[model samples]
Target chain A: MSKNNSRKIKQSVFIILMLTPAIVGFFVFYIYVNFKSVVMAFSFEKGGETFYGLDNFIRFFKEFTLPDTMFKDTILNTLKSFLSTIVIVYPVSLIMCYFIYKKIVGYRFFRCLFYIPAIIMPTVSAVLFKYIISMEGPIDVFLMRFFGRNVPDFLQDGSLAMGTIIFYSVYFSFGGNILYFGGAMNGISQEVIESATLDGCGWVRELISIVIPMIWPTFSTLLLTASVGIFTASGPVLLFTQGGFNTYTISYWIYEQMLENNNLEFASAVGLSCSVIGFPIVMLIKWGLNKIGDKVGA
Target chain B: MKGSKIKRSISQRVVFAVVFVLFCIYAITLIYPYIFAFNAALKESGRVFTRDMVSLAKPARWKNFVDVFGEFVVSDSGYFKMTWNSVWYSFGGTMVKLITVTLSSYVVCKYRFKGRNLIYNTLIFTMVLPIVGSGPAMYKLLSDINFIESPMMIFTFAGGLMDLMLFAYFKSIPWEYAEAAFIDGAGHFKVFYKIMLPQAMPAISVIFIMTVVSCWNDYSAPILYMNEKYPTLASGLYSFHERIRYSHKHPIFFAGALFAILPPLAIFIAFQNSIMDKVFLGGLKG
Candidate 1:
């Protein structure tokens, strides 16, 4: 073969060799697993026999429509978790990041302190938090001493369990948003900020008008990613409540099905149903965000 | 603007003071738990429940750390074995992912090949298209293939966030270097492995540390796939906690929790700057 032909062959070989692992991984782990999930969703297991149909999906839908079903409850809990992240966690994190960006007193210390949770194992944090808020734990003791009232079992009380989980979720997310938004804000031109300040832009106005718009791309990306993870919006459920106390989220319910119940088909049905319902909504949200991003020149 | 040069209005100063106080309170909340854990871990196991948890440990039981090695056993794996498992699991998985991402990203970013765009688009598409609840299917597939409890399960992480980050990293590096290496009689493999790969080391190392930290702390995978035989520190700690939940071995469990966090904590402290800066950049750019 000629030299050019040999190089072409070599290049082709190189590309194939490089791409093989990723391709195999994609096919087996992503494509094959998803395909199996779809197939499993449409199938049911009989006594030592496998039957393919819509039995699992039909059962899922039937249960999902029923009032007070675990399916409906878990879905609602997941939605609540997602919205809490968007409405409460995101804004709180943003405001905190703004103050940190402004070089608030002890900003460096606060920045590192906030990031501690992100680095620590979620299991460890959950375990510690569980004890800290337990009936006779620090919070309880403080409440009793100061308020002359007994503290409720935060994680055990059905009314307070989900709220506690949401609180944990919000606390855990602060470090990450601080890092991301802080970095984004760091990238903002100092000259522009100085100009805003010279224009008499106060803290709130600067955060609303100048800082937010400048970091819009990062904010939007985080928002989009959070939306993409809507179905998986869960705290450390296994460590905290084990899906008890009416705090089950969709992801935990799916995990429970697989790990505890050993019901792969039903789990797949639920998962596929989520994807079917969630995909279009996510797409529309992405489209809407993109449109807004364009308008805002993000 | 210099700190001294920028003048804050009265309202801005007031806002700053309020924000500062709020941050201080939040900081205390963040720090208080770890302090409690430290004090609680040093207390006698029985006293942890009986005594004031807010106070310092009386007659500090430093042996709790040593005792955890003996007490905190999950699936017949002790503390040292679990730590070893954590090391191999995190490093092994991270190396596999890094190699896969680096190799594929270098090839796709540099070489003019058919299906290159297809591969790129596929990576991005799969990333953006969230596939929730495939855990059951994944578990089944792995079990069927007998990959469960096997180290070979690391290959499943071959394509993920690192792929896009490294793809972007490699794209920025000029192909002229590769051409020069080829002209100097270096083969394609030599050009990639010797010339281009070294240049991508900084990006790879950042991702490597991040992935290692994540993998080290990842309990779910080991809990599900490693079976009861091989428990990493995180998974072992988890199961250990469950085992002692009713027994009220709070001190021993807290000691184990503290032990499990040290490695990752050390890593974060060491790479605080790189992690804080690069991770966000990777996310934004990807």
Candidate 2:
């Protein structure tokens, strides 16, 4: 055989060799485990005899009920929490990137300072926020000194609890997003900015016309990935809210079923349902944005 | 108009400065709690509010770290064993991930093989599935199969498809070098090892550090599987905090958190230059 054919053969074998460890791992752990879970989800535990059917799933959906009280409050709170972060963080991150790209003084210092929270563990961040918002914590302590009024429990107050959690979530993670957006902004050529400047445009005009348009692709990338994740991003809630039966999102509810409640079938069903609902909504929105962005570009 | 340009430049600088300061102040607020945590850890159990503790002039209780290490028995027999366990787990995981991801990415990017998009799409699909979604079922399956407490648990924890990050990095590496290596009569392993892996080292290092930090800081796996007899530092930290919180005698629990966080923080600070280069430059320059 020629050297080229021999090389192809060697490459194929090597590829197989390289792929073995991950393949075995992915199959044995994730795929096999998930398969088992799927099978188990169909079976019910009864006196060590497993009865397999759709009964578990049927029971889950039929029996799952939301009290008017729960449906009324946590639903709104969850929506508010989710929307608030997107509304607040994305725009703020974009603006922050804008300044950094402008090469503002102390840009490096500001960038580093903002990103400090990103490296800290999420649980630690939540606990730190909890302390900060506590009655005796710095904010309240300062407020009490000025207003002579007792500061309420930020975590416990129904009206403010979700907002506060959302605020902390957004604030803590803003630094990382700034890095992402800044990187995207910096990817745009300096020549483009200079030419736009030469066209009798100032910072605001250049920003509005050029930078925003250029970075919209990155915005869509973020949207595609992160928007679907709002349902599943329950780590902070787990750490902070503890259960959020008071402010329970669907993901938290799913967690309770799987871990705390041990309704594996129900949990799987809920998990599946959340993916089903969230994925399409995210895809549609992303698709719509891309179309609009393309048309706007045109 | 020329005068206006001067004023505009001045205002622009002023706006930049103002925004920069406000941003700094905002970040300081985020970090203030950690600073307070540091201060709280420094105070002796009951002497938290003493007159001497009121001022920064009062030296921080550096003994807090000493007390934490004492609790860890970190000086005693086999203290470094657990650290080794964590390192091995992360290393093993990274090796597996690096191998799988590099090959899979090579196939998807370099070759037009069958089932290519299928594999790529499946990998992307896994990104949407939360580990928590499968956690309960996985725990049950592992328990039933007698896999809990086994060293194999490390593999389970690391089996998520991280091909996206790997693939993104691989795509940036021009195909020309690999082709040249192939032309030089190098086998695939030789090419991957000598050429691809070396080129991907910057990203590999970043991702490796990320994995190690994750494994080292992880409390859940050890807490769930290893039982009390085989506690990782995080589990130990949790238990220690429980003891302190319940006893109302803070045994420098803040110091414990500090110790828990310090290794990763130090690693992060040491790599700060590389991190900026890799994170932004990799994305942009690619």
Candidate 3:
């Protein structure tokens, strides 16, 4: 056999060996499941995967178009939760990261404290917060002692639950992003910043001109990912409130649907229907952000 | 002008100190939950509701820890077994992950194979697509396959994000080392497993730690699919919480939560630098 032919055979064999796990994983985990899901979206779980012929889709739509339907609140709340993090977590983390990056007094201490929550179980964190905010918990205890009156029940009050959930999310979301941004900031050569300092750049000016511009790539990367986070952000609601009190994000709604005695197909259909709306919105936002970032050259 | 500038500078320093103090206060707020848990877990049992949460009792209720572990002993709901299950899941999943990520990534980065970009782009496309309601579908598939209870499900699913990062990391590695290894009569397997894998260790380790931490913390998937028989530490802890919420005292639950959190916390502290810093860099710098 010719040497080149033998080498070609060897290469082909190697490629197959390398690609098998990925191919299998894709088929088993992603493709097959998704294909089945798309089909399941057209069926009813109550009837044991019996064909429903867009009935589920119509039900999903009715959930939005009709008043007192669930789909509207869930999708809206999901976006609201995502936006809350964007408003609170994104900037605060950047600022906190800047402080840590500057190696401010006790920055190391603060960094560890901030990052610890990201590693702990979200459920565990939720439980901690739940205990703290419960009627008999610290928040009430503190308020009753100091102010001679207790605040409204946070977890159970329909009005306060969403805010409480958002607070929990934003609080925990801080450290990981700060670590990411701080790491990116650390990548900026010290000489660049020191030279700016020598040139008498104030903190605000340095942050605006040098830091933001230099870290633009990482910033854009995170921003683009945040667009995808729109659909993904449910904010530990499963553990927090079990998605009750007007707090059911789409993710939680689907989780709740699946847990029902006869809603697996209904859950699959609702998920598919939401994705139809959410997927395009996410993609559009990602594209819009990318264009803006590139045009700004940030 | 000079006097005004000095005055301005002194005021700025004062402002900075005040801001630092305020930040310290804010940081306490961020950390207050854990502190409250620790204090509550140690305080005298009946006083948890009445006493200020921040105060540490003279004789700490260390029996909280004993109660948590001991309660698990009388029942089939084994916290130790669940933790062991979590360890097994992390281990087994990470092993499968190293294969799926490292091998495919090495191939994608190295070989000029047919349809390589197809493989790569397929991954990117799937990632951007919203997987918002993918659970029921995945659950159905797993159930259909009779594989719902096993830990292997967790292993195979670590593909998308980790693979993308691994591909980028592998691409950045210089090809000269592989060439040298090949010249020394090493085959494809040796070049991948020995040469490339070691070089890719830093990036790989970051993903490994991430997978380990995430698997240890996961509650839903195990609870959803694994049923009552083989719950992970997370789901097991969750079930234990629900079971004992009204029955057990607050200290016991707090101790259980603290124990549940400890392993991942240790892992995070150990790898805080690698994860927070190098992970973003490694995962993104493609």
Candidate 4:
């Protein structure tokens, strides 16, 4: 074999070797674990019997358990979280990036400061906020002093708890949106703006006609991502609530039911139900967006 | 003309200055909590609880740092070997991710391989699936196969496939660049290692930093897999916090969390611009 052929063999072998751990782990751990979860979902634990078939799933569907309430809450929280991301986070990010892109002075400092939250670990953020939202924390203390009123327990209150979690979801992801929007803004050429100005277009007109249109593809991508995340968003609730409150999401519910509750079979049934629910909702949203996108293109 | 130009420039400066100031206030609010956590970490136990919540302590308690480090249990003779273990896992896990993702993404995005579209869509769909829904099925599988305890769990089974990050970056690279290398008689590996890898450095760096930071700070996986022997920084923070839950709540726990998060935070500040640039621009151009 020539030197090139030998090099090719070595590289291929190394790449294959590098990939071996992951491939083996995926099959053994992920594929096998899930397959067993399916089996266990049908049967009860502790007896070690095989091929019970559909009983666990039937129990899940039939029983009015805590997991059922949790399932409903999870779906609601997921939808609420998505709406919050879309309505608040995305628009705010676009506007903030617009200001920064226009170099609205001291942009560098502002940009750096806004981006800090993105880099912090989610667990740390949750713990920090735990202190911040405490009765004696600055914000609550101030509220106690200023209005002569007690600051409500943000985490424990069932009605307000979901909203509080959703609020952090937006805050945690806000930095990423700024970065994406800023990049999109930067992609708009100066020449296009100048030409639009020469054509007697106002600043607003230029932005709407040129900037928005130019970044439509990025918008489409973010929209799809935002929608998909609605079905599966996990961070704030996981780190903050630990799915403790009535605010337990589908994901957390599955986790608790499987691991903590030791209803391995029931958890798998719920997991399957979630996948069944989420997959179609996601597909429908995408189909709708694509239809709108195609019409816009047309 | 000069007078009008001067007025326009002045107005522009004023507008920019106002935006800057408003944004500063917003940034400060977001930053204040973390900065307070840092300060809380440095405060002595007494000062942490009794000191005015808003005021800085007179003499900082640096011993909180020592307490966190002391929690790491190395066998008979080894000290800080746990940290070394974490470092190994992070690096090993990231290496696994980089190789699999790069190859998988390359085949899908670049090569006209069979089952390409099916693979791509499935991966993306899986990526978006909620962690809770997947956890039960995944945990049972890992446990049954005796993978729960292994370090390999970090890279392959647990966390994520990271296909989205790799796919977004892979799709962005122009076909022409890869084609040019092929035309020059570069084999696939040669093109990947030398040409494609170099071009995709920004994406690689982003993924590398993210993987390392995530692995370092991860709490759940270590709690699940390592059990007692090797806990990552996040789990360590949780353990430390739980140990001294009452009196040391303010400073010591905050200190541990701060110390746990610092390495990643420092990296973030140092490479902030590059990270942001890669996140948006690198994936959007193509």
Candidate 5:
């Protein structure tokens, strides 16, 4: 074992040579880039960036302390959509996943149909959604008859835009999540399912008790990733609102800062703070889910 | 008891029927858009402008589809250039991802180097640590380094999700194959390319399809990084949308979208078996 270990160390030069590209990439992309973000977050760069001792952070917190600022709206918007993802989107998709897994009536056709959109460019789906939901589009025409005149532009109205975005997101959420949970359920031995059935377990009971517990890793993984969506998900906000009409997200804030505003220092500050705050929350959610899984599995 | 069993079955049938109907409605919502978009893409501008929605085909004017591809893509260049760009992006991006991921994961799996766990853990750690801040920093780095047009940014380290799965995949390969090659005086490169890389083909294929589809569809990256000199299919389509959005000609818009969707859609439909093999095997770990 010691001889093998020494030889492995001797091959360390070869290993280093093999790993050069990725290592350099990791340093340049991950380390150096993140280091700059953190540095810029601390420093105020509008008038020649210098370390200003948390002034940028202070400015962000003070400004976003306002109930209606862009920063506040972005954070709020991210939360609303992310919450919907957790509460509404995931559960609905999980149910869809369950049905698909069970091969419930035209599953293959339905699976292909749903999953195809995910593989297709989001640009395509975004265009399609925009086509239908635009002012005086099909939905508008249908609703125009109901209200008889002046139906709300679903993607334009401040009150309705987030809902529209969420709806579109949930509409496509069926694609990957189904394949995933289906794959997980497929991993479960048929003998287990058959024995459960023979023991007088119905589909619902068996799923809740046997299948879900078995697929805990997959379930928790999806849940945890979705939890992190609070910081990351910017779905159709870019298309729908362009960070306007009370639809800014943290991600959109970062984007708007870069493209529209060119205030990278402030964007860095906000972005850094979001991740710093978000990291613990994400970890908590993951830990809590794992704990629950342990209890349920037990 | 017999009556109870029958009642139970009757209720089950009703439940099944309800679920089926619900799922059918859901499936229609998912699929009907493509059908609508296809027919709309074949319509005349005059028909599209009509307020009345009609399912009846009014002698399908196929010119809209052709015009969308030929006439008004981003700038004077048409669909062909953008198609080439899309091909470059996906092909280049997938190649880069495979090389970077396969190499890095290979090292971690095969080597007993110090900091292997640290590198692996850090990569996993960084996945959840939102890199929104890094966008502008990266933009600065790219623009300053003059690699915005180079597609070198796409070649950077990745596999935030795939890292562990791929590591496991590489580790699962019998080390004897590599050892045999090494004993025959095969260098690391020879052994990796010849023995190990081919062995990791299933996982690599999953990563390939994912990266290609994503790179093909990804609009934001090129729009952010590259100028009109290197417009990808996705970014080109987006730019065209900006130009033609107010034209109120639904057919052309639908045609452009359909054009953009076709490649990735065709790829998915064609290679679904392999895609399913990965998804079923990997279980959407990403």
Candidate 6:
């Protein structure tokens, strides 16, 4: 071979060697795992007997329909958590990002403060929050002192536990929103904002008309990603409630099935079922968002 | 027009004031938990339940911090061992991930080759397409392959969002530097290591710290795979808390939790600017 051909061969070898590790990892972890999950969803394993078909998926649907099973509650809680992200966390985070972007008083301080949750371990946050809302913790103590009555344990009470978990999830999520939306807002032109100010556009009006539309790509992407994670809308279930007090989301239920009960096939089925159900909904939302983006020229 | 500008400024100030107060209250919520944890960790274990949580720790037993090292044990691994586990796991995982991601990203982004766009498209496709509920499948695969509880688990982090970030970062750097290195008799490997990699170091370092923080705090993987044999601080502390949930060891547990948090907290404080700026940039560019 010529010297140029030799160099070309060398480059090929280099590329192959460089890409090998990541390719291997992607194939094994991402592709193969997903493939196996689909297979496992169809396979049935019980009492040392192994069979293949839709047995596991059938069992999943049956359990899902059963009134006594926690499946219904898990689905409902998951939806609630998903709604909390979209309705509560997303809008609230966008507004907060706007305020910080506008350089509101103490904005720098608040920016640092808000990003704290993104850095800290979820385990640490959950532990701290757990203690804070425990029976005799500060919230409890405050209620007793101020209202002259003791409060129920937030994490233990079935009626309030899911709400508490959702609250924590919402709280922990803002930091990430700030990072993304803050970055997006940074891309907005200062000239436009100044022009809006001269036109007497107030903060709310400016945020609604200018800042949001400018940052709509980021906003819409985050929103769509949250929708994709609808089935997996989870709090720190293991750390906070351990799937107790009717606070189990679909993700946590799947986790519990696999880890605790050793029901891999069942967990796979439930997961695959959720994916099948969630895919179209996500696609619809994506399409809808894209149309809106086109309409607004975002 | 000048009057309107003044009016806008006045309205903005009013809004700013309201936002500032709300932020102060929100800031209190964020800071208060850590403060409470620190105070509670300093209190006597038994007294933690009896006393008002807002009250300062009477006698301020600093011994809980000292005792936590001994008390926060999982299986045979003590707190120090767990800390060591965390250090190695985080560093090892981050290094493996960054090295692979950096290498792959550099090659794919810088060099034009066959299957390059395919690889790039695959990465993007995998990222955008959310495949839900593969945890069980992942666990099974790892167990079957004897990857569970093995040090090799770090390699699994080799390809992820880091790919997109590093890819974007590498793509932006002009190839003229490589051409210069080539003129000076540098080969492909030397060009990357000597010329290109150094230029990419700032972005890599930011990603390194972020990944290290994430890996340090990751309890789920260790909990599922490493189990009791090799418990990192997060997992060991979690298991410790679970073991002693009913016992009067809240202060000691809190102490361990505080200790577990300090490394990442210190890291964030040190690299706050780079992390905030670069990570945001990476997110957008990627």
Which residue ranges in model 4 land beyond 4 Å of their true spot? A1-40, A43-48, A64-70, A258-261, B1-21, B46-52, B71-82, B107-132, B157-191, B243-249
How do the candidates rank by DockQ, highest first?
1, 6, 3, 5, 2, 4
Q: Candidate 3: where are CA atoms >4 Å away?
A: A45-49, B1-15, B43-59, B73-75, B155-162
DockQ of 6: 0.61
| Residue-pair clashes per candidate | 0, 0, 0, 5, 1, 0
Q: Which tens-of-lDDT digit does each residue in B168-271 have in candidate 2?
A: 77788887998897778776667777888888788777777767777766655655665344555555555554444444434366666665666777877888
Query: What is each predicted model's overall lDDT from 0 to 1?
Result: 0.81, 0.65, 0.75, 0.66, 0.74, 0.82
Top lDDT prediction, candidate number? 6
Q: Which runs in model 2 stand beyond 4 Å of their true positions?
A: A1-8, A46-48, A52-78, A256-261, A296-298, B1-11, B46-60, B72-92, B125-132, B145-147, B157-162, B215-230, B279-281, B284-286
Per-residue CA lDDT of model 2 for A1-298, tens digit only, reads 6976976687677656655666677787789877766676667777878788877667655655534445345445556666766788788888887887776666777777676676665435565566667766666767777998756877787666666777777777778788778777877887798777777788988888888888777777676666767666633555556555366766666555544546776666555544556767777777788897896582
lDDT of 1 by residue, B1-286 (tens): 3554446779879888998988888888888888899988888775445446666788889999999899888888888888888898899999888887788888888877889888888876775676787888888888888888787767667645227667777877788988887788999888888888888776888888888999998877888788477888888878877866476778888899898999988988888887776655654554
Interface RMSD, model 6, angstroms: 2.0
By TM-score, the candidates rank as: 1, 6, 3, 5, 2, 4
Query: DockQ for each candidate?
Result: 0.64, 0.38, 0.51, 0.38, 0.48, 0.61
For candidate 6, the docking band is medium
Candidate 6 residue A133 Cα shift, in angstroms, is 1.4
Each candidate's TM vs. the true structure?
0.95, 0.86, 0.92, 0.83, 0.91, 0.95
Kindly provide the TM-score of model 2 when superposed on the true structure, using C-alpha atoms. Answer: 0.86
TM-score of chain A of 6: 0.95
Which candidate, 1 or 4, would have the higher DockQ against the true structure? 1
Q: Write the per-residue lDDT of candidate 6 for residues B1-286, one digit (tens) a residue.
A: 1232233357567777887898888889999999998988888776445455567888899999999888777889999988988888999999988887888889988988888888888776554455668989988888888888777787778645237767777877889989998888888999999988998887888888888999998988888878567888888877877866466687888898888888888988888888776656654645
Model 4 chain B: ten consecutive residues of lowest lDDT: B1-10
Better model by TM-score: candidate 4 vs candidate 6: 6
TM-score of 4: 0.83
How many steric overlaps does candidate 4 have?
5
Error of 1 at B112 (Å): 1.9
